[model samples]
Target chain A: MATTPDLTKHRKMHRGSRAGIARRGHTVAFGQFGLQALERCWMTTRQIEAARQTITRTMKRRGKLWIRIFPQKSYTKKPLEVRMGKGKAGIEDWVAVIRPANMLFEVDGVPEVVAKAGMRLAAAKLPIRTRFVVRGRA
Target chain B: MKSVALEAFPRAAAKRNAVKKLRAGGRVPGVLYGREGSPRAVEVDQKALETLVHHATSETVLVDLSLQGASHLALLQEVQHHPISGSFLHVDLHAVRADEKVTVSVPVEAVGEPVGVKTGGGVLEHVMFKLKVRALPKDLPEIIHVDVTGLEVDKSIHIGEIQPAAGVEILGNPGFAVFSVAIPKAEEAKPTEAVAVEGAAPVEGGEAGAAGAKAEAGKAEGAADAKKADGKKAPEAKAKGK
Candidate 1:
């Protein structure tokens, strides 16, 4: 199913500025290993779900996974061949506005090698560059 | 407890700019406070501090800090690091007397593979990575080792069950789980079965079919009302335009 909030205060939202490094959710808190975003980007629900599936399959469902980012901002899209200037388009897909150093996924109860390999495959599914981080060390 | 000897220099400038300059010069600004005359501002070589941290087994590091010919036994209370770069920004050292009891959190290590994990296809999980304990300077342990060889599936080891070292007392909720061997989570159902289940439920209703039908009827009524209102407003808008 498509990921979207059931309730929202505002159905439409403006595209705001994306600046500054992530001050929180940057550390590996839940798991022993994590994938940290090195570049800022809007991660859609599909992308996050795809990465999660990749990580879970890589680990063979032996470990636990934590998804740190949520698609909070909803973006709008105009239909095909539609003219401009009809105010803003309807709400399309929701996206998580990720910043530098934001931790995207975390895995635990698995060996370091397996977690690293899983994160590498998951990073391939994402749009931004990522860094493999270990708990306490990073 | 292992003690590392490090030399520090008395810092003259504690201002933000001064601290920034000091960091740029490869020194980490720190404060030594506790049972002392006053909190002393000091700086240590960045590389040295990093090495000390890298070599330590746990977060609780006992430091033999020497500043301006005076030696003070201090605990590495806190270390602030850059979130992105993970570089040392500042350090806080707490001077402690050898006779006083100090409370600290020590990393917990599980020794040996659990029986459940080895034979029962269970996953061993470290629920609590660190345990807070109160101990004298000499009694502080670098790390606490817990044996989990006999742990069975769905079984947990709690803090109350642990026996600490002599002169050290575990401080926290006694019932807190430290380690457990859990049965792996069940896999998802087959796609066809999941789809069949989804198809059985009403598409528009939140849960009950009657409530869902009622909501759909309400939506249709609201849409008809909106269309009627729009039709009435169109003529008024045209007249105003003319």
Candidate 2:
């Protein structure tokens, strides 16, 4: 299973500045063959899990896989007919707030053709749109 | 500035599979582009090339490349590494004459802490990491060091201010800033509050007006506190007191 940390009892983080869309580290994380998101979207923990499973299964453990993003931001929701001003709703799930040009997954040690095919299958499990990218001359 | 001797063999085939085969055999495929001739495909031992690159102190390395019973002086131009594994993939070497001048980017390093950052509550910002310099192959310095100890707040070191080593000429706009000492963002936002209080004290008319002005200042302070609590336009609180 993909790693997920137990972040219970964590103090509520102050609503900080929005993640700048043009930041550097938001791009590709690891490996040469990867998928870059073209649109900003949120990837829930379960969705990321499904994508990870799809990629590893497709590759058949032949090469290395790197999940560049993590669902660290805690998301919350309120129940129906709830009154206003009750502090905050309990944490429901975790999500990664991904922006454009953010690399969602990467594969290495495999041929370019195999990595592309495997990443295509993984991209099907995600809600946001992504494009295949190859590490080339920068 | 140091020269390392390495042996390379001319690759028989220029096909993709042949390059992969060379890599699998613990060799890195490379190309040596000469000044007046077509590029030649060469393969160097992976371990030797990696060690030479790792030990080299500068971005530009003088390579005494031996290939097919002939040796040529070259400069290591570019290196490609596997994105994940950090292993050498391919390298580009450019043939150079020992007496000719070559332009290369040398890393700029700061040697001392600026007084503005150390005692004046300012921050030192390094604007340039690498500087382009043209010099003879023998006179190239590994790295350029800038002494920043004399820098004061609001002062900056420009490209024109730096003294390059003899026979080396820096290539860029002379006025382009290389490094600077500037007030920190948090400190830059602080002086307006003091200005507002000083501006208000002299404008009051009489004793009764002074009391009313004090009440207004207290109300403004309360509004500023409320704005801070709401986490919106906290900096505007200082502007509002004016």
Candidate 3:
């Protein structure tokens, strides 16, 4: 999992899947907006508090927005273990991991919502992105 | 609907002064809360209470309201608001049947982006407007949808991902996105600023690079300090437990 952090740096990136381009769909740039990160689900009590401080101090004030981000951790238990073998090459197996990261945020004003959110992301260096914008309907 | 025998009282009955004020203004204050028994009322607004009810839990819930007339049986459904001003809207309600199941939409939460996080350095996003569901009054859920399986960055998720319990039926579109993940590009990642050295032997003009780094750091620090000078501080308060 730790290999080739820079591999994608060379490959041309686009929006949607390969099939989309094949059907005359050009991939738009993904996450053209902000900071992003990959972290374990579990956070210590201290880590959580620290994160809250970072978001509120920087994002809320300058951004003029209220954000709600909730990070979560998950784990899996496996039965396999490594045992000493003298004669042959060691063997290994593949496995998967999973977790959730639900969060939400809101801004008071219009247009400013996205701009402030963007500014907050820059200041906080948080690992999040803006996906879509919707208007509240009457 | 599974019927529940609920006991409710007025939320504002103790505020006699407020009631007096409302009575004088001709806006009756009332509450509508009940599962089995009739809804109680101290005073109900022909307009305001109706608007508040528009946003409340439905009739199966035990609402404690007051009215000028006797208490009655009812369920809350809708809350009306000013479309542009976004003020508190009037509430709508229905008289509940003990044996009937009421359907309402609850909220769903999704965390993290799958596609964006994996490839584009983007993260997951959520815009969970709401999800409608049907359940008996006795079986109401404050929130639902715990499992978030196939989500990825750049990929949108819908209501179909929710795993409803045996007795409940979800009433929204299967393609609804309670949450999603994406990288909409809010910032750019410039090369990390270099560390500065003080009076150290420069290697092949390393001093120039160091000077540039110091300048960037100064700029960043200046930005941070300016925030403090503005008297705009974040809440130094700690996070409370759920």
Model number with the top lDDT:
1
Cα shift from native, residue B142, model 2 (Å): 0.8
TM-score of chain B of 2: 0.74
Please give the CA lDDT of all the candidate structures: 0.86, 0.74, 0.41
List ranges where model 2 is wrong by over 4 Å: A1-138, B186-242
Lowest-sum lDDT 10-residue window in model 2 chain B: B199-208
Candidate 1 off by > 4 Å: A80-86, B186-242
Q: Rank candidates, DockQ, best first.
A: 1, 2, 3
Cα lDDT tens digits, model 1, B1-242, are: 86799889999878999889999999999999997689989999999999999999875799999999999889999998887899999999999998899999899989999998888878888899889999998889999999999999999999999999999999999998999998666333333443344454222121234334657998999899899979988998899899
TM-score of 1: 0.83
Q: Quote the B-chain TM-score, candidate 3.
A: 0.47
Give a tens-digit lDDT track for model 2, residues A1-138.
333456646734333444545244443445657887767777888788778767765654245667888876776677676688879887667777787777788775456788888789888889978888865422
TM-score computed on alpha carbons, candidate 3: 0.37
Write down the TM-score of model 1's second chain: 0.76
* lDDT digits (tens) for residues A3-65 of candidate 1: 677788998999987899999899888779999999999999989978987787678647778
Question: Each model's number of backbone clashes?
Answer: 0, 0, 67
Listed per prediction, chain B TM-scores read 0.76, 0.74, 0.47
Recovered fraction of real interface contacts per model = 0.45, 0.00, 0.00
